[model samples]
Target: MFLVYVDESGDTGLVNSPSNYFCLSAIVVHESHWQTTLNSVIGFRKELRASYGFKLREEIHCSHFIHKPGDFQRIPKSLRLRLLRDVIDFQASLLNYQIVNMVVNKKNKSLNSDIFSLAWQTLIQRIENTLYHHNFIGSNNATDSALLFVDKTDEIKLRNLTRRMRRYNPVPNSFNLGSGYRMMPTQWVIEDAIHRDSAHSYFI
Candidate 1:
């Protein structure tokens, strides 16, 4: 079975504000690989702490390192930059995994807005193709389930708008690991628990 996780970035309200440019990030992996991937990242973080005693999650006094606070800052800037460059250079050796990402340019407006849905459609079409063609995923399977980790900073706004579109509320911030779509707050302590398993699974 295929496990899909999603997340979103940027504000869901007015575009002229400081947090403009709404982005939705998603990372889907085969269920078979879920535990393997999560365990790997978790183990790596522990090694970092043991080897150098470098406090990874500075914000919280926790030991299980899947979603440690300040992990974005903790990871060496050089490594982050390298991935950006190596990823584009067709450097398979450097890529962490095969993934796809889509973003709604809120410079124009909210995703549910008429203008934004145009762009949103294209993003969905691409994702549909990716999921269909993935060998590990196997699209011919009659049943499919998708998960979403939406950044509802504009909870009141997005929920109302999306309900109008989907005819119901998408999902709430009840994160059941990879069992179902988790609508979570975009805070470190909360968002970090999802980092390694479905790190970019913010939106669908």
Candidate 2:
């Protein structure tokens, strides 16, 4: 089994919105190393707290930590750079993990459906492709099942979208116009929708 933890950045609103881009990011981890990965993340957070006086309870959002002037602002520039560099290093050191990101430019074209839903559709397609590749390439240890975990902030909306995708194909007919009889990948997703609060979702 594998776990695909997802989180999004930016609002779906296009009018009077601050962000120009919306992104859906998923961190895929195999079941065998799940506990170790969780522990390593917790330990990294603890290290940050001890060494940099960073708050453990606060989430490590990239934009807020790097661009905005708040919690990380009080720290020296050199230290901030060091902390971020170390974080990148730690992420690179992880084994059997994959980070998949889908970024959309909200202003590029008019969307047929809500931006959030479209983003989810694209994300699911990418995930399905990953699973398909894995099943074919890693035949000896092919993944049998996978679960998706999303931030609980938009639980209702996310759950509704998941249910809709599971019940019927959401991909537009226009997408498959060129490819004959190509099925969309949403069916591979598990029906149960799991939501976790970002405050406690360290692995996400």
What C-alpha lDDT values do all the predictions have? 0.42, 0.75
Off by over 4 Å in 1: 51-97, 108-125, 135-145, 149-204
Model 2 lDDT per residue over 1-204, tens place:
778899888878788779998888888887777898888988988999888877878777666666784867887767777777888898998776788899988997475537887887778767776775674221246544568988854667777776766656544455647634444536556756588887888876
Name the lDDT of candidate 2. Answer: 0.75
Residues 45-114, candidate 1: write the lDDT tens digits: 5654564454435322222233333554555655444433432453233222345566655565544575
Q: With candidate 2 superimposed using the best TM-score fit, by how many Å does residue 74's alpha carbon deviate from the native?
A: 4.1
Best by TM-score: 2
